[model samples]
Each structure stands twice: as C-alpha cells, then as structure tokens.
Target: MTLLSEFQQTQLPASYANLDPATLTQHIQAAKAQLGSKLLLLAHHYQKDEIVAQADFVGDSLQLAQLAAKNHQADYIVFCGVHFMAETADMLTAADQQVILPDLNAGCSMADMANMYQVTAAWQAIQARYPDEVMPVTYVNSSAAVKAFVGEHGGVIVTSGNAEKVLQWAFTQKQRLFFLPDQHLGRNTAYQLGVPLEQMVLWDPTQGQFKGQADQATRIILWEGWCAVHQQFNVAQIKALRVQDPAIKIIVHPECAYEVVQAADVVGSTHKIMTTVQQSPQATHWAVGTDHNLVQRMQATLPQKIDFINPIACACMTMNRIKLPHLAWCLDQLVAGQVPNQIKVDPETTEKSLSALQRMLMLS
Candidate 1:
C-alpha cells in the first residue's frame, strides 16, 4: 500500500478505449469470478447503474466503508466511489487489506474545500476569540487529514445518518461545535435538534474567519462547503413539482439547502431515501433531491413514480469517473497481480482518523 502523496500515476490503459460495453462487462464479471472471495467490490449509491451492477455491495459512503472493514476475507477492496471514501476504507480495513479506487481522479469537491491548514487556522481563531472548549465534528465526506485533526482534538466523525446523534453528544462535552465540510447537513441536523438558526454560524475557510460574529453565543459553526450535486436542488423545483401535482411527495438528502429541506416532505440520508421510497407503498408520486444516479436508479427499479427534483441537476461528476471501462481495466490489472489506484493512508493519519470513527461507532 502506497500513500496518496507517494502515488504517481494510475491512468487507465488505452487498451480499454475501444472495448465495447458487452466486452467490458464480460471482462469485469470474469475478473470477479476469478478473484472470488479474494475481492470485495463496493459501490456507493451515487455510482451509475452499470457500476452498481458489478458491485458485491452497493451502499452509501459510510455504509460501504463499514462493509469494507468487516470483510476480512477480501484481500482487495475495490471501492467504486470518490477518493475520500476509498481513503476511509483503507483507514478502517485491516492493514493487510488493500483498498483500490477504480479512477485515481475521482475526488470529492466538498472534501477539497477544507484542508488541514485551513482547519488549523480556523481552530486557532475560534479558540482565541471564544475562550471556550470548541469541539470538532467532521462529516465522513472529508479528507483523512481533517478526520485526524478532529480525532486529535477529541472529536468524533459523523455521517448524515448519525449526525444528530453525534452532534448531541458533542454538545454535551463542549460549549461549541465546529462542523467540517458540509454546511447544509450540519445546519439541517442541528436545526432538527432544536438549535436555533441564530446560535448557528458559518465559517469561511478562504477568509480565515467566520462569516459573521461567531461569538460565544454561537453553539454551532458550520464550515462553508456543500455537495455540488445536492446544492443544485432549490425551493423553486419543489414548488414547480407541487404545482404540477400536489400529490407528489418530495424526499431529499439532508445535504440540500435548509429552505429546500423545509419544503421537502421527507429528509434523510441516501440509505434512508431509498428505504422511504421502497417502503411507502401508498405513495405513488415522488420527487427526490439528491444525486441523479440514485434517483434515476429508483425511477427505474421502484414501483412508485419517482423523479429527480431537478432533472437538469448534474450527476456526481467524480462518481461518474468510475465507468465500466475503468472497472474492467482495474480488475484486469488485479488479475495480472498489478494494483492500480490503491488508496493507503499513512499510519499516523489512519490511527487518528480511526479514533474519530471509533468514537462514532461507539455512539451508534
């Protein structure tokens, strides 16, 4: 396992360029069958249908990471998700197990928005101003370095599904909480827990400060970052859907804006969204605001008339990087005893990151 910083090149070979879809699928399936129990293919829900079809397990980022950690038989954990997710799997899984991302370039935009330097500076400024214990809570959609920082500072990692539970626990330990990466999720979860909007503030990493007067009264400081996919859905889309058919129920991910979430009939994690749509047999019409791939998947497989709130909403470009050709090429390399795009976190980073993750696990 090579660290990301030491990773040099992992571009897909030109041999796969002309391969037809059927050929690619055959190659992927063959490699899987050959690898057998030695391989565990994990795909995030945001992945395209073809990728999901080849996955041994299809779930959200955290769910996939947890699955990777539990599968001890698999020597290779091929994660068909973004870079951050792969990094997480590597951190959680046994040191002997290698985690691979099909495409080296598949990275989360939200994770890139906040880095170690910016987070360190923000913590310093907040401590200097507030004179209170400020707890750090990072979303799973963040870099391992950020998670390490949180862990070193005695904080816990959180996901959309367990954010409320973790945040409540954080508040019990500290006077203030600094949420990393995704502002919408932090704000939405805190609001649901009865934290007033006035008590929550926004932190601007670019400016090296908070957006407003984030004083001692500020209980929650949200980092200025969001998911490019979920941010596309707005209140107007909900209104249009309502006007088109009042019977249409709007289910959305918590990553959407607060206004959009408020207008939504149901708000949850990606797993929750899938379960809600599948279990609600009485609801026929539905509008989902999240990644386009997952919504499109539901539309095709589910009995309900499901639609993406914003049809024009761009698919997760990073997740789309893991195409059928890329998967085929990756698996073929593995068959040849060559590892490509393997994600490996350094020892210090992995240890610290696991501290935060384990804290979350304990709470859960």
Candidate 2:
C-alpha cells in the first residue's frame, strides 16, 4: 500500500509574528464571525486556553471527532490538536466538510511510534507465531494507515476512557490481543481486568519481535510506545505530592507508567480527570498527572484545589505547536478563500479506517 506524503507547514508571515495575543484573538473572532455557522473550531482539552476560548466545541480527541461528524452544517472544521486527531476528524466528518490542522508539524509522538512498515512487519511475525489466536487492537492515537490496517484485519480501536471495555471485547473475539502504540495504557488496562504481569509481553518494534519469549499464557502483546508527557510523571512526583499534601487525591491518566497509575488514588482519561476535579468539592485538594495545560486550566478555575504532580510543566510539545498565531493565520487563510493545513485521508483509507473507528464507537 502506498503512503501519503508528509504535509509541511510553512513559516508564518512576519505580520502574524508581529501581532500581539490580543490582536490574534481579535483576528480569530472576526474570522469566525465572518464564516458564521460554516466554520466549526474544535479544540482538545490539552490545547492552550486561547485556542479553547475560540473553539466552537472543546473536548477529548474522540469526542471532538464525533462532534465534527454530528455537526454536518459546518463547511470547515478547524481542529486544534495533533495531526492524528485532525486525521480522525477528517475521516469522521462528511467529505464536503474540510478538516484543517493549524500546524501540520503538530503530531503525536506515541502515534508516530507505530507506522505502516513497522506495524505490518510486526503483524506478519505475530501471525506466524499465534496463527488465528491474536486480534489487533489499536489505540485511537495512531495513524489512519495503522487504523486501516486494523480494520482490514477485523480489529477495533480503543480510547483511554473506554480501553477496558474495548480490551474486554477484544479478548472475547480472540485468544490473544495485539495492542498498538502505548504499552503503558495496554499494561495498565489489562492489569485492571485481572491479567497478571507475566501473562503480558512487550513487542519491540525496533527489534521487529517480542522482547522476550511468548508462551501460550501470553494474553497481550504491547507495542513499546508511550506518551512523552505522561511518562514524565514518575513515582518520585507522586511521593512528593503525597508528602506535601497527604489528603490530596492523586488522579492520573492511564497513559502514565503502570507504577504511577498504581500509586495514584484514581486513574482515568483527560475528560475524567477534568470532570473529577471540577465536580469535586471545593475543599478537596487534588493532584493531577497529565498534560500541563489542562492542569493549569483546572488550577485557574479551582484555585488552591488543584496542582500538577510534576511541578515542572509536563506539556505535550506537539500539541503546543498550535499556538494563537497559527490559529489566527489558519482562520485568516480560510477567510481569504484558501484552505491552509487541510487534513484529508484518501477515500480507500477513510472507508477502511472508519470501520475500525465505528467498532470503537459502537462498543463505547
């Protein structure tokens, strides 16, 4: 199968760089007003506050994609997230509705860890060993090509919030599970479902095989990939946070290391963490382990009640690439009758990948 060429984002004009944050905000608002209902801005929870302020809808990646699909009235869907997220929105939205990423360079590191070549090679080797015993289960934070590959093999996609249910469904379908990208999420979720550590094996894509011997007892094959931001939160931070505030409830994302998830009082997705923090009593002190921006947002809304486990910012660098200037420029281009940084998956890939995504939606 042929791969799509990389989309390179050109450097913004000097005028955009010269504009202040207030000016950029003005530009974005003006553009949105001009486009009216034709433009739909979707922002992820991890986005900067400025981007979220201008968005028509703000939620997690899957929620935003589903919203894009549901709102067919929009002519343009501006996705303020990573590349994989924009691709997802493009695949889910109507063909007439264009999906645009503010910055083409913004991409998920975890998703990039599993490309077509590496995934196909791993699939071939695993099939040879397990035969009909394995089922492919990819996280939503992956490339469309990878999702299409999973669809072609009768597999389903999983999200952080609904991982356990999806994994449970996968186990019912096959004897063994091949989880893609984030190994930490796979390990953490499988452990919750009563699968012991020894029963799970790690697949080193660099080595093109399992890191160790896989016996019949092996129920999961986790791809050795992780979120750079989530991995930054370690046991030390959890320990320090506990020492600072013994009563503070430690909540973390499953993307964090197994040790961190185990150490925390609660483990959940981004949406879960936000709602937990927001809905909790004002007296409840909370320590969140996820993207720095989301934590910062919570801190602003609920002062003194929230703090990041890692005192040093653990921001998603790729997500941060879509700054106020990029958004302002993207909207400016759209208002000028041009589509900048548009994300479009081919019809063949879209059809195949949508099947896998649909399976996830159905199960969720």
Clashes of each: 0, 0
The global Cα lDDT (0 to 1) of model 2 is 0.89
- Candidate 1 structure lDDT: 0.89
Q: Residues 1-364, candidate 1: write the lDDT tens digits.
A: 2235667657677889789999999999999999999999999999999999999999986688678777888999999998888999999889899989888888899988988889999999888977667889999999889999999989999988888888999899998889989999999999998999999999999998789777667889999999999889999989999999988999999999999999999999999999998998746799999998888888889999988799998998988988999999999999999998888899999998898998877776
Candidate 2, residues 175-198: lDDT per residue as tens digits? 999999999999999999999999
- Prediction 1 TM-score vs. true: 0.97
TM-score, every prediction: 0.97, 0.97
* Model 1 misplaced regions, further than 4 Å: 1-5
lDDT of each: 0.89, 0.89
